[model samples]
Target: MKKNEVPQDGDNLVKGESNWLNYAVDQNGEYVQEISVGWEPENIALEQAWEVVNEKVEEARTKVLGGQLSPIAFYMEVNIMDIPLLANYMDKYQWQVRRHLQPDIFKQLSEETLDKYAYVFKISRTELMNVPTNKNTK
Candidate 1:
């Protein structure tokens, strides 16, 4: 796969407007909400989702703190099983991920100029949030 080519999986992996979905792990595994964002992007949905998740995590931290933002470490476990296509794209062509998302330009993601991509996963926040701090620590 080349850098410019899009993945093989068809579009429409996620439907409708750009929004955030929540799923609880311990419960019956139901979708909690679809928090809609005012802006939309055809292919940068994951970036948007990451920003939203980061925002919520910050809010949680703020509540935990005395209403002040603090730098806390966290992990995000995205099940790429569903979005295999996007995963492949990232693996094959995403230079940032290739270099472990290092360097200023990759961290900024300013080079992601393409459009019209899709995500096969559910794109939920709770799942992403629980990844780093889950009880499976070694």
Candidate 2:
């Protein structure tokens, strides 16, 4: 597909779980089973799997959002000056580079951590990408 082509709404996985636990009666007022409670993972791999699944899901979401805004999006190249030069550097540049920071902040803040300090703010997609740069580093 071309870059500027309009996208058809594909099948989107409506994200999130349903509240299957809370239950009562439907048409006939009957007692329903309470939400089943499950014990925590007994091993390491099971716990790690959950974390990995969540990470991939969030990454997919970011990709979709990035695609939708790509036409109007501008990406800025950032070189962190404070990062000490690594002795094992192999790339052409020695400084740390970054393109996105909002996602970084979001990832850093857990659901609980973010809830404590979270404040809503309005921002355009351009602002999220740092508004791009015209100057060449070279």
Candidate 3:
């Protein structure tokens, strides 16, 4: 298919925004520069992605309410980060991050450690200490 032509229905590239290479010719028939024309297809992939995120958030919320997971775990799920990724972002070891996932351990964290986590999560220490009951509140 030509670069300038949009894909028909059921094409593989129909999921998200796509770039089309466009070209023009001068009066003397000299080839001019090309530009990428961007366009988005009509699709529900974005909605589906959001649904998955929401589902994860709900799962985390359940764990937090059940006392099986710490508030930190809920925030991590809300931010769509796993233990290793969050540990890397906070520059802490994986074991330390895992420990923090325990409510007892999280409550015992030093103010400095709490500050570091708050910085990474972009929230105040108070908010981190008090996990919201509803994900929508965040």
Candidate 4:
């Protein structure tokens, strides 16, 4: 693609900022780095990916509310993390993190443990403890 051919079709992911890096051919017939506002295909792909993420998060939320899983599961889905990754962040073993995903085990967690999770998720302890009741709440 030529530098001048780079798409700037307007729908930016970050409000008004355009920070997508792309490579294109310059007038000199050499490769050049270009900054694009966005591309239609890339935007569509990202939208689809977010839709999947939202679906998973919703599924986890329902499970938590039904006592099938813990709020940790919901937040874990929201943060796009699996047990192993979450355990790495919490400095815990995968088995221990998996146990915390249980509703009963979550209920028995101490303030210190909850605080550590909240820190990883960048949310308040209260937010970490409570799963959003609806999509709007999230």
Tell me, by lDDT, which candidate is best.
4
lDDT of each: 0.33, 0.31, 0.76, 0.89
CA deviation > 4 Å runs, candidate 3 = 1-42
Q: Give the residue spans of candidate 1 off by over 4 A.
A: 1-43, 67-138
lDDT (10s digit) by residue, model 1, range 18-82: 35433323244443443432223434675677566656554444432342211111221233222
Best by TM-score: 4
Clashing pairs in 2: 21-35
What C-alpha lDDT, on a 0 to 100 scale, does residue 10 get in candidate 3?
Answer: 40
Candidate 3 structure, TM-score to reference? 0.69
Q: By descending TM-score, how would the candidates be arranged?
A: 4, 3, 1, 2
**RMSD to true structure for each model, in Å:** 20.0, 20.9, 5.7, 2.0
Clashes of each: 0, 1, 0, 0
Model 2 spans > 4 angstroms off: 1-43, 68-138
Q: By lDDT, is 1 or 4 better?
A: 4
Worst 10 residues of 2 by lDDT: 71-80
